[model samples]
Target: MLAIGLEGSANKLGVGIIQHPDRSSLEHNKSVTIISNIRHTFHAPPGEGFLPKDTAKHHRTWVALLVAQAMEEAGVTVDDIACICYTKGPGMGAPLTSVAIAARTLATLWGKELVGVNHCVGHIEMGRAITKADNPVVLYVSGGNTQVIAYASQRYRIFGEALDIAVGNCLDRFARTLNIPNDPAPGYNIEQMAKKGRHLVELPYTVKGMDCSFAGILSSIDLHAERLHKDGKRWTDPETQQPITREDLCFSLQETVYAMLVEITERAMAHVGSQQVLIVGGVGSNERLQEMMGHMARDRGGSVFATDERFCIDNGIMIAHAGLLAYKTGFTTKLSDSTVTQRFRTDEVFIKWRD
Candidate 1:
């Protein structure tokens, strides 16, 4: 089965074409081949966040070009496509609409089925496809979402989630406070800084039951950043006696926030009695997070599953794979039902493909 997927729920717009083999060729097992994956990002300047209006414009300007480029790269004709897929929700409204409209246009023009995929489920299915992780606890983290999930009863049930702002949002706002670059991603730049850090500054760690919170941590770190800026950042680290640098703040924030995530994920794993844990979403691309999760999983006698930027960090291939799974299950979004929203929950989608 061949499908084209368009993803633009955030600053990055992606287009991908992928194909799944027929069971007649590969019996008892299935494989997915990514024909093409193209992405275009609309990053804000240092110390700024991307606005919905500007992000929507970016998707509108690049969607057609990206789709054409993906088709060329995939070397596929329009007739070969079985379906058109797009992210449906739990993202910025304007950007989601922009991509959804493009997907609807393509579906209508090609006379193909339209599969509306949940952004979080896209991440989960793509991670599973890449890592071959079967029945693992899922950690879904991104700019707009922070969730710990477990699969049961044809549903990806949420074990825990952010009570306020998501972890990526906290990191991005911290990056803004420090005026760090957002070219690749704010979290990535922070991870780079965290590598050079020796001192761990104390920050609030709020884990309420299974859920976690990051707004307080962001507030605390932002105050520290403000004070350091006022002092020209010449403050001394009490532990190392070395100067407290911005890198230290990044390191501390990562350590604290990641610990909160690990704690909740571990609890979910214990509850679900799953050995493997799969990390998904844009923040799942963080090496630090993967390492920390690996440590926790190992201690529990399990493994941590993660993907690189191509799959983990919000791309079209994931949408294509997940949407195709739904399409194969005889699911298609009607023209009247093809809409985008900012508040679609992860558990809202029924996982009919999974046993």
Candidate 2:
């Protein structure tokens, strides 16, 4: 079976095709193959996250081109596709709507079934398939989400998340505050800085049970910048050295926030008694995070699995793979049920098929 997956929930427009063998012996709930995955990101302004309307415009203009290219890369035709899937939100509405419309139009034209999959599920499923870490605690940190999850009753359940801003947003804002180059993602720039910096400035660390709050940490950094400006200390000038540098701040921020995630995920693992840990989403690309998780897992005699950019970060292949599973289980949403939502809980999804 060939399936096309559409992911336009944020700044990315991903189109992926997956081919699955017909095996009646295999359970419907089993994860399957990924044929070819392709993704195209829309242009966003520096010092800002994705804007809903602007992203929507990019989707409408560029989705067809991207999907066509993906199809070409996969060496498949539209007629060969058995089903199409699209991200049905917990994301910005405009981009979600754009992808939804594209998927709907294509499904109608081809007379194929359309599956609406959750954005977070796509992330975790992609990570799981690539790593083969079943029943592992998941730390899914990205631009729009910071969540700790575990599989339960055939669905993934989020045990902890940010009450305010996501960890990625906090990092991006901090990168912007320092006038850091925002191209190629702020996290990349911050990671470079953390490697260079020696000083470690203490930052606020807050974790209430499984939930975290980043707004206070962001405000603290802003206040620190104001103090530096008032003291007439310029990082650019070598003579006027400040007690804290942007590099140190970036390092501290990463250390503090990621520690919180590790603690909460560890707690979830204890609760679930799962030995495997999987880190998904864009921030999972950070080597520091992977190292930290690896160390923690080693301490517990458990293994931590993380995806490379090919699967760890957002891509079309994961979405297509997830959509195929959902389709195999006869799990689908009607066109009317594909409404965009900003905050859909992960545990709210009911898994229909169990092996």
Candidate 3:
């Protein structure tokens, strides 16, 4: 069966097609195959964040073209597709609507069912499919959410999450302070700059129980950036009494934030009594965080599973895979109830596809 997925919950617009093997052909638990995955991002200028209005406009402009391209690449006719999938919630209101409208239109025009997928669940299912990380603790860190989740009783139960401000949001704002370009991504540029840094300046580390906080840390770091800004980017390191470089601040922020994530992820693993860890979402692609998570998992005689940028960031293939999983079990979103939302919780979804 073929599923076409649309995802435009943020600055990026993506469309993909995935094929599910016939039940009799399935082997070794593998289920879905990516037929095509194409994406386009609306990049804000340097030192700026993308606004919802502009992002939604970008999506509306590109959604049709991306769908066409995805279809061409997948080599499938409308008749070959069994369903249409789209991200329905837990994202920017306007962007989510833009994509959902496209999904609804296509499903109506093609006479196919519509599968509305939870954004977080899309990431989890994609991670599981790619890494085969069965029943691992999930560390889902993205621009909007920071959550440690575990599957139980047909639900992805949240064990921990950010109290305020996601880790990726913190990084993006910090990149703005340094006027980093958002072409590839502000976070990606920051990660690159962080590699050149030698000093790890002190920053507030907030971890309470299983949940963590990044708002306070962002404020404190912003102040440090302000000080440097006033001095024309010439500030001294407080701990070493040496010149503070942009790279130093980038390095410091990543270390502090990633350490907190690793800590909470470890706690979740222990709480769930799981030895496997799976990292998902855009921020989960960070190499340093992956390394830190690897060290933590290894020390506990476990391992960390992570995907490259293809699966790490927001994309439609994940939506298709997840949506298809549900669609196979007779799940379909009614057209009248296909409206998008900005605050859908991950735990709300009932995982009927998993045993």
Candidate 4:
């Protein structure tokens, strides 16, 4: 069976086609084949963040083109698709609604079933499918969400998360403060800069038991940047008294925040008595973060699993994979019930497909 997925939970709008082999052929390792996966992202100016209204407009405009492109790349027609999957929540309302509208339109026009997928669940499912990590502790870190999750009683239970702002949000906002380019991605640019930093500037590290907070760290860093800009003073390393560069700030932020995430994930793993760890979401693509997580897992006599940019960042394939799982389990969303939301929780979904 084939499934087409539309995803625009935030600035990125994606269209993907996936094929699931017949039940008899599912015994092989490659049961699922990705036909086509394409995406278009909306980039705001250096000091600006993408607004929901503008991001929605971008999705609405490019969704049709992307869908057509994906279909062509997949070498399939509308008649081949058995289901249409779209992200249903935990994102900006306007973007989610825009993508949902496109999905509904496609389903109605093609006379196919509609499947609603949770954005976070999509990430987790894709991570598992690609990494072959079975029931590992998952750390999902994105621009909007930061969570450590484990499966229990047919639910992906959240063990820890950010209390105030997400770690990606913290990095993006800090990038804006430094006027970093958002062409590829602010986080990627920050990661590159961090590699060149020699000294780590101390920043506030706030972790409340299991949950962590990044708002204080962002504020403190912003204040220091402002003071340096206003007074024209060169930030110096406390030990060597050498001038500190912007790279140092970016490096410090990544190190501090990623360490906090690794700490909480380790705690969750110890609590759940699990040895394997899976990292998902956009921030999961960071090499430094992955390195840190691998070190932590190795020390615990375990290993870490992660994917590259294709699956780590927001994309349609994850939604398609997850929604198809639900569709196979006799789940479908009626047209009347296919409304988009901005606060859907991961634990809210009943995992009927999992034992």
Taken over the whole model, the C-alpha lDDT of each candidate is 0.91, 0.80, 0.91, 0.91
Error of 2 at 218 (Å): 1.1
lDDT of 2 by residue, 59-92 (tens): 8998899888888888888788878898887788
Please name the candidate that would achieve the greatest TM-score relative to the true structure. 3
**Root-mean-square deviation of candidate 2:** 2.9
State residue 162's C-alpha deviation in candidate 4, in Å: 0.6
What is the TM-score of candidate 1? 0.97
Instruction: Record all residue pairs in model 3 with backbone atoms less than 3 Å apart, i.e. clashing.
Output: none
Better of 2 and 3 by TM-score: 3
Superposing all C-alpha atoms, what RMSD in Å does each candidate have to the true structure? 1.8, 2.9, 1.3, 1.7
Question: What is the descending lDDT order?
Answer: 4, 3, 1, 2
lDDT by residue for model 3 (1-355), tens: 8889899889988898988885333331376688999999999999999999999999999999999999998898999998999999899999999999999999888899999999999999999989988889999999999999999999999999999999999999989988889979889999999999888888999999999999999898888888787887668876789888788889999999999999999998898899999999999999999999999999999999999999899999999988888887778999999988899999999998776
Of candidate 1, the 10-residue stretch with the lowest lDDT total is: 21-30
Hey, what RMSD does candidate 4 come out at?
A: 1.7
Flag regions of model 4 displaced more than 4 Å.
23-30, 231-233, 237-240
Candidate 4 per-residue lDDT over residues 1-355, each given as its tens digit: 8899999999999898888885323321247788898999999999788999999999999999999999999999989998999999999999999999999999999999999999999999889888889779999999999999999998999999999999999999999998899878999999999998777788899989889999999999897677567756457656667777788788889999999999999999999999999999999999999999999999999999999999999999989988888888789999999999999999999988787
Candidate 2 segments whose C-alpha is farther than 4 A from its true place:
23-31, 227-242, 353-355
Model 3 — which ten-residue stretch has the worst lDDT? 22-31
- Residues 1-355, model 1: lDDT tens digits: 7889889999999999988885223211148898999999999999999999999999999999999999999999999998999999879999999999999898888898899989999989888888888899999999989999999999999999999999999999999999999999999999999999888888999999999989999999888888689889658756667778898899999999999999999999999899999999999999999999999999989999998898888899889988888888788999889999888888999988777
Clashing pairs in 2: none
